[model samples]
Target: MDARQRLIETTRELLHERGYVGTSPRAVQERAGVGQGSMYHHFAGKADLARTALERTAALERERAEALLGDASVPPADRVVAYLRRERDALRGCPVGRHTQDPDVLADDGLRSPVEQTFAWLRQRIAGLLAQAQQEGSLRAEADPAAVAAAVAAVVQGGYVLARAAASPEPAAAAADGAVAMLEALRTPPRAPHRA
Candidate 1:
């Protein structure tokens, strides 16, 4: 990889493993195997490098979510279930969700923008899927797509938090299973015609 790409990729990994506060320029340089001059040449400083890395992470997340949720061949409700149950590094926590806990990152818009945007996009995407499912009669008529979408997003993040705190992946797996069960409950058959 080129010097700049190396710096960004390394910074992305470091930022995921260590929040903004914990990741340092020296650490990024060491991980990237790039000299101070090369690092500075590509990025003005740590903040610049972090912003680039965070943007890459956000873009990747958006791409994956779009590919899964936007697939035309899969039923909308099935897409939601698939996304919720997809394999994740639960004990390590969400790479994007972890950023919200860092005061340093929250203090700077450059760093926080991607984290905020990613969740916002996810919630909207999930809501869209739910609405489509409802229109298709997969989801019950009374189920509120927006509210359910928020809860679904919460389940994933909460699962990560619980797993990280407990130092086990089981909690995360259970949370995801529970979410799927709840979503399944939302499904209902179309009503039968009334007899005259």
Candidate 2:
């Protein structure tokens, strides 16, 4: 890759492996195999490089989510299940969600905006899918789409934490299974046929 691309990719990896506080400009330059001049030429400084990398990471995550959640051929509930069960490196934690714990990233509005906006969009998108399912009589009428969406989002992030803490992927898998089971319970029962 080019110098600019290498710098961004290296910063992205560093940010994921180490939070903003730990990813020094020198480390980025060394890892990227680019000179100090190359990095400064492309980005004003470390924060600038981090922000750019973070924005790219956020966009990639959103795109991946959209692929599963936006498939019209699949049932809405199934779409949600697909998202929950999507392959993840539970032990490694989420690329974007991990940033929520970073003080430096949270403190800077510029750094935080992409992370905040990505999650908001995820919840909103999931809620829309749930609402659609409710309208189609697939989901229970009494179920609240927005509330369920938030819970779904929570479960995924929580699952990651649980997995990381336990040093096992089973917790994340179990959490996803539990979420799918809950969704199954919320599905509307089919009507009995009328006697002739």
Candidate 3:
């Protein structure tokens, strides 16, 4: 890869492994194996590079989500289950959502925009699917799509935290299973056939 791309990729990894405070320009330069000149030439500074990296991470995450949630052929509840059960590095935490814990990233509007926007888009997208299912009489009409979407999002993030805290992947897996069960419960039961 070119110097610019290398810097961005390196920064992305550093940011994921270490928050904004830990990902210094020197660390990025050393990790990228590029000189300070190359970094400065490509980005204004650490924040600039971190912002680019965060944006890239957010985009990739959105793409993966879209792939799972975008299929109309799949039942909406199933789509949600697929998303909750999608392969993830549970112990490593979310690439984009992890940034919300970083003070530096949260303090800077430029750094936080991508993270905020990504989550907002995710909740809205999931809510849309739930709404569609409700309209189709597949999901209970009493269920609130927006509220459920937010809870679903929280469960995933919280699952990561639980796994990380417990130092095992089981917590995350259990959380996904629980989420799937809850979603299944939301589906309307098939009506009994009538006898003459």
TM-score of each: 0.93, 0.96, 0.95
Model 2 segments more than 4 A misplaced: 193-196
The positional error of residue 73 in candidate 3, measured at the CA in angstroms, is 2.3
**Deviation in angstroms for 80 in model 1?**
0.4
Tell me the tens digit of each residue's lDDT in model 1 across 1-196.
Answer: 9999999999999988878878889898898899999999888899999999999988997887787888889999899898898889998778788888889889999999999999998998999999999898889989998899999899999999999999999999999999999999999866799999
List clashing residue pairs in candidate 3. Answer: none
lDDT of each: 0.90, 0.95, 0.93
Assess candidate 1 and give its lDDT.
Answer: 0.90
Q: For all candidates, what are the clash counts?
A: 0, 0, 0
Ranking by lDDT: 2, 3, 1
Over 18-137, each residue of candidate 2 has an lDDT whose tens digit, in order, gives 999999999999999999998999999998999999999999999999999999999998999999999999999999999999999999999999999999999999999999999999
**Clash count, candidate 2:** 0
Which run of 10 residues does model 2 get worst, by summed lDDT?
Answer: 184-193
